[model samples]
Target: MDILYTIGAVLIFAPFIAFLLVVLIARKKMKYQSIGLAADLTTFLLFFSVPVSIKAIWEIDITALVYLIAILIAIVLLVIEWRQTKEIEILRYIRQTWRMYFVLLALAYSSIWAVGIVLSLLHFFRI
Candidate 1:
């Protein structure tokens, strides 16, 4: 059970690691976006599976905390960009460029927490 939680936490945090690697190594826009997309999608599925298997939930788990932190980081990023630009231009640019990734990440990120909560509700469920 603890191993499952640790593995899930690692998967959830893997996107941040991928982001750093892409920035430091690839330095290619496409590569960075690809890594982000792949990580979010993979972690989304990985988190989705464990709860389904255990038929239970773990309360106050690291995976849920990681998801929360991810959401907060995203909110901070958007706020910083908006504050810096002080216009709709950045939004328009994101809409034109990384909109799909942004949308998917948002959905997947939210879903991870929801799943965690529901899985946590079941008695004796150790995710």
Candidate 2:
């Protein structure tokens, strides 16, 4: 059970871990980016599966806070990407690739957090 919990945690955070590795450490290496994206997709699946995996898991209720935050962040990233696309010609090399990866990362993170919140609620209710 402890090992299962540990593995669940890892699955939940895999995207963030991969993103950090690819962005900070790998420095845009194509191979690394591909691996990171794959991990991120897995993270998405794990996130969606949380309720099924944990018998006590329940749906989260968050009004629109998460959506609002995600919209704000997406807008900010879009602006930055737009500026970079205009100013740095070489940015074209990474623009589409980076944008795709960024969107995937954001989605994976948000989904997992939502799932975690639901799981927390389930635990609280002892369901």
Q: Top model by TM-score, which number?
A: 2
Residue pairs clashing, model 1: 56-125, 57-119
- What would the per-residue lDDT of candidate 1 be over residues 1-127, giving only the tens digit for each residue? 9999886666544444444554555445565466555544554454444344323333334556545655666566677777877764665545433444445554655566676667567534754
119 Cα displacement, candidate 2 (Å): 12
Task: Work out the TM-score per prediction.
Answer: 0.30, 0.33
- Predicted structure with the largest lDDT when compared to the true one: 2
Model 2 TM-score relative to the real fold:
0.33
Q: How close is candidate 1 to the true structure, as a TM-score?
A: 0.30
Which parts of model 2 have CA positions greater than 4 angstroms off? 1-34, 46-60, 87-127
Error of 1 at 87 (Å): 2.3
lDDT of 2 by residue, 1-127 (tens): 9999886666554545544544564445665566555554554544334333333333454425434554666566667867766654445534544455456546645666687788789889999
Candidate 1: RMSD to truth: 11.1
Shift in Å, residue 85, candidate 1: 1.4
